[model samples]
Target: MQSKTSSYLANLLQFCIDNKIHKARKILHAYLLRTNQFSNTFLVNRLIELYSKCGHPTSAHLLFDQLSARNIYTYHAVLDAYCKSNDIDNAYEVFAQMPERNSVTWNLIITALSHNGFEKKALENFYLMMMGGFVPTRFTLASVLSACGGVSDVGCGKECHGVAIKLGLEGNFFVGNALLGMYAKCGFVWEAIEIFKGLPEHNEVTFTAMMKGLMETDRIHEAFDMFKLMHRVGISIDSVSLSSVLGVCAKSSFEDFVVVNDNDRNWYNVHGKQIHGLVIKLGFERDLQLNNSLLDMYAKHGDMECAEMLFDNMSEVSVVSWNVMIGGFGQKYSKERALEYMEKMKNHGFEPNEVTYVNLLAACVKSEDVETGRQMFDDMSCPSLSSWNALLSGYSQNEHHKEAVMLFREMQFRNVQPDRTTFAIVLSSCAQMGLLDGGKQVHAALLKDVAYTDLYVASGLIGLYSKCSKIEMAKHVFDELPQYDVACWNSMIAGLSLNSLEAEAFIYFKQMLGKGMLPTEFSFATNAGTTNVSLGCQDQHCEYVKILFYNRYLAK
Candidate 1:
């Protein structure tokens, strides 16, 4: 028969495990003192574990210190408490002071180090643990595999897999899942697939890892195929898997639907509807992040009607929900609706973030509503570089070159520290207004910023110089690019055509083709005027002219 004191101690420990002892804690401590249960090592260790899980690591450590004769379990509980608190240094201190070490102790420290971004250190400890003759368990292998994956060390991961096979843990669910995640993240897609296939059981986490890995490596179609397989296998779908699938669907092309009057690049609206139904059936419609994904899918799929309906139906909405609506309206050039929602979002007690202002300003630009854009700019409590660039973009897009230059000066006065986009838009404004002196000042400032060599900014500088009739400077900027893309080549060609240097344009065109860059439609459009130049370009490049026409027709 159990004694009354022992029964009470058992009940107290159960209360702690169930997280129902917060108010009764003082009484329980008083009773423990009265019953002399503090002398029980098992009771003390259980209290430490309980307090740590309850987010009271300090209390757990105090309890551990109060023990007159601590056992291995007491030390393990305290170390775990410190690790849970993210106090890795303290955990290491406790770990080093342990008189005897076991496999569990090594695994705990290795996992804690890995979790805190010390993957190299975690690997070192794993090696040391083996040298000390402690055999690695499934938990130990999982942690080490994660460390290997963190550093993208495929060789180490493969060696770990060989060890798993020797230890007969290849099909162990937890170990198999960890190995799957390891190989997938390390870009060993085929090996990951094989592990995933050989798994004795599959979980939602397993599928999500495989899908994310496939998506990361640009194998989108295969990911979708795997997703369908999961559905066939009746594996439960969750928000993460749904989100990944929706993202891939958005990027997929719709060549098969082009003949059916579906021209949107993202024709995934069909698949989106099916997934939305699943979310609803699973009673996850109230999930904030899942709702956000559904909203983005609808907006990008060109189904604003569905997006607006979903927004209206949401009883519990977040700021991202409102941002999605604003962005969708901006996409449709509906400035009024976007502006209305800006107020609606504020009324709902959410302040507009940088993305809100970006969408609002973009809508204003499309509608040529410069006054609203200026108002929005003034409304920002602390305008960032993105805000200033947004206004500058609006001015440049509307051909308000003089106003844009004025805004640029104001940006300098406010010390906002213009970024790459700022230089691009401001240089464009200078080119339009033929402000050669201002363009030169902007160019001088750009020379000091290393980020200006980014493709867009460099291209804008080249075009600006050509428009100001400074072709030499344009070439100088062009020569400085470390690597050139199709847009970089197109900008150079456009500069030549603008300056009536048809001969130079054709020579650069040949150079671009020699670099194996397929010319875009914009490329042909810019060079279309070169044949009418005064250089007798038509007589000089008659054969190439015909080839251009053939390609242009194909582009059409």
Candidate 2:
């Protein structure tokens, strides 16, 4: 017992699906002539959704206008249409006109807000839905959790976790995964790990979350163990797992951990080459991030030739890859090759970021290409603070003390305030040039600008005063410092030795040891010719010599 209106609607739907738009419109017009009941609300809503899906929102709006009475579903349909077309404002308008709203209505609005980067607003809507007595489903919680994670709103994320637990939705696979992702991304690595360990069952998503969390916290060993556990449990690894492990391999300093036998200088190289094979077997060679990670791993292990080979074979090089190759060349002191890669990066339509410029500046500084460095600095369209510091450091390192001072003043004139590194470099320059007046001026400006005194800055200031032959001023800065590390004491000792005050240097060295501070090479070297053999060999002094020897050997 199919009604004539239903039959006509079915035929229209079939015509719409078959790309017969004109035929469908003619059929609908004939139906309207034959039956007064053809303009039913359900029929109209169907036509609107069909037209909107067919990429004709204007026609959908026209069909929606012909409806005599709009139900909640009709409004929802139109709102969805507006959202699909990326006309969020019109969707909001349709939502506002709804006389009554349901959970579906609220979910749509929340998702729209999240997509538009209105994370705060999306969370607010979630709260409103709760106040309206609508119990959120798993989809609702997932969307809200994602929004909270986007803004790193740890407080709201915890609240959502509590709500999910109370609603007995914690075991829902999607909800659990989202919660883990939120905790991991928000720096709650310990909490994320606890959640993973306590999970009733583990999935691939669970393992990925735990691995990502551990990696984010710099617990590379723990992350690798988790990956191994995943393999033992027979869980399939995906792109994310491979990417995370590659990142760990890239950042881990293998030389520091791998103890090579006396006969084998190539031990670390062998291990790194094995890892490179694993990367190929996993078929991640085409992944830009993973490829760059492999390149970095090989470069760090002193296999620059293999690193270069990998770089040449990359099908698509990103800005990160370019930076890695450039930095590798810079580390090897190959200025010409580094500059050529930098030009290639630009020619490939990849704009250089702060890191790229920093490496280039370091290369220029090492090559003593002060003129070229200055040109690069001047050509920057929007120089970051790090960029300014690099240029100033280059000038200082090249013994252009006056030029460094000039650049500092020019930075101030341009309203670019100097950071801690800038002060450190400039103070070191003042020390080299014996510019007491400039040092004092910088000290005053530092106190005025820096809210908290850094130990490094204080040490630099002390070294500057001592080199300028102002030992009293050096003592004043040192005495005012609230905390003193070994470096601080080393600076003072070196300063005393430079002034030919060997006795004072030895005395300070004894005081540093009394404060439980260890002596460094500079400290030992400063007291090398002191007239205090008996003092040096006092109680447990043999142990001190052993420690010094060990540290010196390791340093070499």
Candidate 3:
């Protein structure tokens, strides 16, 4: 009869474990107590694990404390319960009191620490686990390597890699993938590549790790090649690999390629289309992240037709999806379509996020609709710097120079603390409006904060003075700059040419050539305009100018 009762209780616990019925589990626990069977340590541990899995960590903890015959299993149950509860302090306290721990115990702590964003502590516990003479399992190695990657602790990562090699576990798929991810995320591209090659086999995750690492290092073309090889080898492609491929596609959206419909089908888009077909064939059409990446890639590549179709068909639409779609319309200068999408987004019960409004402001700027842009800017509940900058950019784009300066003052009044972009836009606005005093004030602000001393700001200052007919002031600003980046030189030449200082502009142009600074399209265009001034100069200077153009072959 006693054996039958124990078996019955075991069956009952199994049912609760399978069905996740915490109430039924509690009732069984009460029956065990009434039958004087509460001394069963194994049964209590199972109950605790069940309760924890059912999201009743408190009940699990209570059952753990009531166990009369506690063992390592019982303690592990409670530790997991505490960790799952995010009560890490209590979990560590229980760990400190445990008289014995197995590999699972150490792995649990490390994983729990890493999951809770205590990666540094996870590493320390890993060291302590090793000192305790516990052999690290595959899970432990993965967690430790992940922690190392999180903090970019390449030294620790290398040591972990060495340990994996010595243990002959470096070839293990999970371990190999972890090491690959670690090296990739830490900017150790070569090591990551080596591990990737050493993997006896490849999986979706392995490809993702390698490709992500390559993209991170800016070896974009090589990354695409790997992606192509993966697809051609008939290796299974999942959402992750597809997203990585899409990221590469987005980056490869240059202007030279052929246009397919509304989208420019660059070299990457061919692969992108193949990956898209593969995604559909694999029945992953419902994957939100992958589809979102596709939408963004298409939008960036000038393929709004594909983006719109994908957006309309996605079963799950996030704010990101809507934003990307709107941004696509904005990119194509379709302000009406963008606004219509904005309304539809609202009708679908999604509120406009910061990105949505930023794109709309951009569309307004593109259409030269400053009034609409201002209205949208005013409607923003929380105006981030991007929002402010968007409107400021709109003002500058539409030749609303006075309004741009006025909005800059409004930004200052509201304590919206201008950033580098703000100064660049507003200074240009002041220059265009011919507001000398306003330009001087903006310059003073740049002087007050060294944060605005970047190349764009230097370019803006030079442009401002030249447009204001203060050639000497522009020269002073140019001479005072400690660095001469491409933009700075371009701005100097452009300013000199536009201000009818042809001789000075030509001297700078020659000096730029001597410095090996290749002229941009703007450089040639501005200098070409100065040819009218050069027309009145000596024949020798005019002939030399033609030689410069012919030799540089600057632009069409």
Residue-by-residue lDDT tens digits, candidate 2, 1-556: 4487577676676567467464465466456547664456666666666666666666667666777688887787777777677677777888888899999999888888777787898899899999999988888898898788789998999999999999999878878888888898798987787777667788888888787777777777787678779878989866667666666655556653355668855546444455567678878678877788788877665567888899889898888888888888877777898899999899989998988987887778778887887888888887889888988888987889999988888888899988889899888888888889988888988988762278889899989999998888888888888889988898888787777776677678789989988777667766664333335444344355456657766766
Ranking by lDDT: 3, 1, 2
Model 3 alpha-carbon miss at residue 402, Å: 7.2
Residue pairs that clash (backbone atoms under 3 angstroms), model 2: none
What does the lDDT read for residue 529 in candidate 3?
67
Kindly report which residue stretches of model 1 are placed more than 4 angstroms away from their true locations once superposed: 1-49, 57-226, 229-236, 249-268, 281-283, 346-354, 447-450, 531-542, 548-556
Error of 1 at 21 (Å): 8.3
- Candidate 2 Cα outliers beyond 4 Å, as residue runs: 1-136, 143-152, 255-275, 299-302, 345-359, 365-371, 384-386, 389-556
Estimate the overall C-alpha local distance difference test score of candidate 2.
0.78
Selected candidate, larger lDDT, 1 vs 2: 1
lDDT of 1 by residue, 205-317 (tens): 89988987787787877877888888889998988888878776655555411234357543444666777898889888888888888888776655788899998898788
TM-score of candidate 2 versus the correct structure, residues matched by position: 0.63
Give the worst 10-residue stretch by lDDT in candidate 2. 530-539
The candidate that achieves the highest TM-score relative to the unseen native structure: 1
lDDT of each: 0.83, 0.78, 0.85
